[model samples]
Target: MTEARSNIAPVLRYAAMRRIRSFEERVGELFLRGQSAGSMLHLSIGEEAVVGMTDAMAPGDTFTTHHRGHGVFLARGADPARMMAEIAGKESGYCRGKGGSMHIADRALGHLGANAIVGGGIPHVVGAGLTYRNRRSGQISVAFFGDGAMSQGILYESMNMAALWHLPVIFCCINNQYGMGTRVDRSAGKLGFGGRAEAFGLIAAHAEGQEVEAVHHAARDLVAAARDGRPGFLEIDAYRFYGHARMDKSPYRSPEEEAEGRARDPLTTARARLAAEGLADAADLDRIDAAAAVEMDAALEADVAAAPPGLPTMFQDVYAPGTPAPRPQADRLRAVLSEAPR
Candidate 1:
């Protein structure tokens, strides 16, 4: 625990983790209050350290994340207000509220997007890697997937291509132990995920995801290799304290198992270590947490008051303007508009 403090500034790492935890907790509260756009919500509550590795990434490096990605995006400096608005389905959101919880994307922040499908975003980083290489951008692309995605054939195919072509890509598998309700052991035949990437001729590493410094060191080395045109794989061992989705209670997991997972929460561990080492007092950490709460609460209020996208704008981003709409659809839209009181 003290080792991480030495590897990186404890204040910086702890602050980021606390902010992510606070942001996700507030989102959950807003969702339960029926302020969010969609009923489906996923949180990266116990896996803050998994995203803490991004501290090692350069600004030019891009990343694609899985559904439970608010922490990852937040760590990369995505505006909390806009992210909240997106979750609330406000027109002011990143994708004009269209992407919602599962598909938030901000190209300017180097966040390609968060994919809903288990393995949907894996290949995207490969494509970005190809683009970076072709442009000689000296940038790397990272793909963050879960243990569940390890079973998906698309992941393997993407890894093979990355290795064969020497693409600057890092395949980061956050092995949170459970994919939905099924434990990883029951799902993946092999416990070691790095071997899967090594089989495809890529440098592979396994690290403790709960320790921020451990993940950061591993990520830094892997990213350096990737920049040199060597693809790599990293499997970070962490656990999701909550169920897969917002409404799920994880009845499949025993009470003892759930308790055990919570005990190892990275936020709690980080705070304890910081306090013990005299790096930061409880008061300092609490102040950061309080500020995060205030920021997120205001964002939630604004998002709830924001307007939803108008029907006329449905196909605006989908297709180029001036393209003729289908006759039947155009007529229906006109009819609906005419019947409105306005």
Candidate 2:
């Protein structure tokens, strides 16, 4: 592993970390203030490194994420104001406020979207890879999912297709031990999620997701391999500091488990590494944090001031052009007779 260089620019790394943390903190505040209405809100508090490392890869690479994906979006250069507006149901949001915490999409930044369904986005990423391969675009598509997604059949199917076609796809499994309320040992027949990829004939690599530098190295190599028309899998052993969802107290795991995970907070670990290696000083990190705080605060204010979508939008974006509109109950009988009797 390469030591942190003193001259290396930590701007992107610090930005990713601060954005994720700020987003999560804002979500909590929004929920408390009754501005956000959702049954669950999964916060990626300690798992910032996974996406931070990804930010170091190709700029045009595409990524699809699971419900717990604030980190991925921020690392991919998603606009904080837009994301806030979306979560607040404002028209300026990525989905025009239709997609809340679980479904944010920004194609311009190569973020296909984040899906609420556990393994729903895996096949989408494969399709993206296929599109890139067909066009010879040299673009790589990535799928970010939790450990629970490994059990889903779609994950296996997607992996099979990517391997068979040699598409440029990277399967990133953020194995945080617990899937909702169930622990990995209790749910997974095979605890090794990376090994499952190898069974489908895909190159698999495992890394400590808690370490930013380690994830950066692993993701960098996998991305390079994928760009060469080789599909690969990366299993990142990380943990979420909070519950699976906002409402979950995580009774499945004890308090001790949560504490142990918190001790290895990825953001803190990254900062410590930089400082210990003389790559950055305390002053630099404090400045980065302060700047991020200001940015997030301004974003929240903008999101609150934006307008919500109107009622007419409900019928839009639902069907293709020239598609016939549904007939009313009273008109349906007359239309049927006019067509059939004629």
Candidate 3:
């Protein structure tokens, strides 16, 4: 798929944001309809500009994501139908129904994986960056985590290692404010996440996730620096318009707060920006949104109808090739009974 690249042409960026917004909305609907694999869907509805980072990245750059990675993967060229299938736990999904929404990954797309652990995936990019540096490949790696991970010691360690080794890696913090039910301000005493990166001698930038163009520009420069063996950090601060998970209604947050957060909708902001700039008129923007909606609607239907992985294949990918597969628990029980009778 063609990309927005360094400049992030306004029309293409708007279209990509539209697709992510539509796809996320469809995911929410899927959960509501009880078609999702689990009750653990984390939507990236309001944080569409985080996907803009993909626009700055070139082919072969690798990335790892936190739980709310659906938008990023989609922007990086994941098939929406397959993504929905994965979220639905269907056989045709990216991980063959094994990895649902939070864990979906495609190595072919340079996505190492989406990890559920707070800062679990950050270190992997450091290792990848080390490999790239040793090979002089000029390729970079990225670790996409959340503000919650700001408190994780592993993140600091990983950042230090990346800087110390002069590895080409980027630590991208998608700071959507809330960590679970708690607000970020309530947790971290010292803010300015970018300031912490400076202590480690890494280039860092912060951008509002609502501004698609601004995010793309920040990411583009960071990508260039990372390719040149300068590890960097980017904090895309946005607001989470929903709860931590699909099941969470977030009683902790007042209705007014949610309203205020929703008002900062990145898609709405980008659409108006595009129109105001004459990059896309209302009709063109509507067409883009309509196309996205159609694409996701079809994807939803396909995923809803897609078959689940057969029970017999449960352990298919669990072990090394040629390793003895574990017998079904029922079969094991029967064998034990037979031996006892003898």
The candidate maximizing lDDT is 3
Per-residue alpha-carbon lDDT of candidate 1 for residues 51-88, written as tens digits (9 for 90 to 100) = 55688788978999999889889999888889999998
List the candidate numbers ranked by lDDT, top first: 3, 1, 2
lDDT (CA) for every model shown?
0.87, 0.82, 0.90
Model 3: weakest 10-residue lDDT segment is 1-10
Those runs of model 1 whose alpha carbons end farther than 4 Å from true positions after fitting are 1-8, 322-342
The sequence of per-residue lDDT tens digits that candidate 2 reaches over residues 1-342 is 124554564545755787789878887776667666465578888788776457655878888999998888888888888988888777888998788879999988998989999999999989999899999998999999989898899999999999999999999998888788888899987777778889888889888867877787788888888888888999888888888877777877788888998888877877887788777767777787888888888887787778989966755666765796544566788878889954
Top of the candidates by TM-score: 3
- List the lowest-lDDT window of 10 residues for candidate 1: 1-10
Residue-wise C-alpha lDDT for candidate 3, range 1-342, written one tens digit per residue = 123223337778888888988898899999999999989899987888886688899899999999999989999999999999999999999999998988999999999999899999999999999899999998999999899999999999999999999999999999999899989989899997999999998999999888978888999999999999999999998999889998899999999999988888788888788766666677877888899999999999999999999988797878887998877899999889988955
What is candidate 2's TM-score against the reference? Answer: 0.91
Cα TM-score per model: 0.92, 0.91, 0.95
CA RMSD for every model?
A: 4.0, 3.8, 2.8
Residue 325 of model 2: what lDDT?
Answer: 56
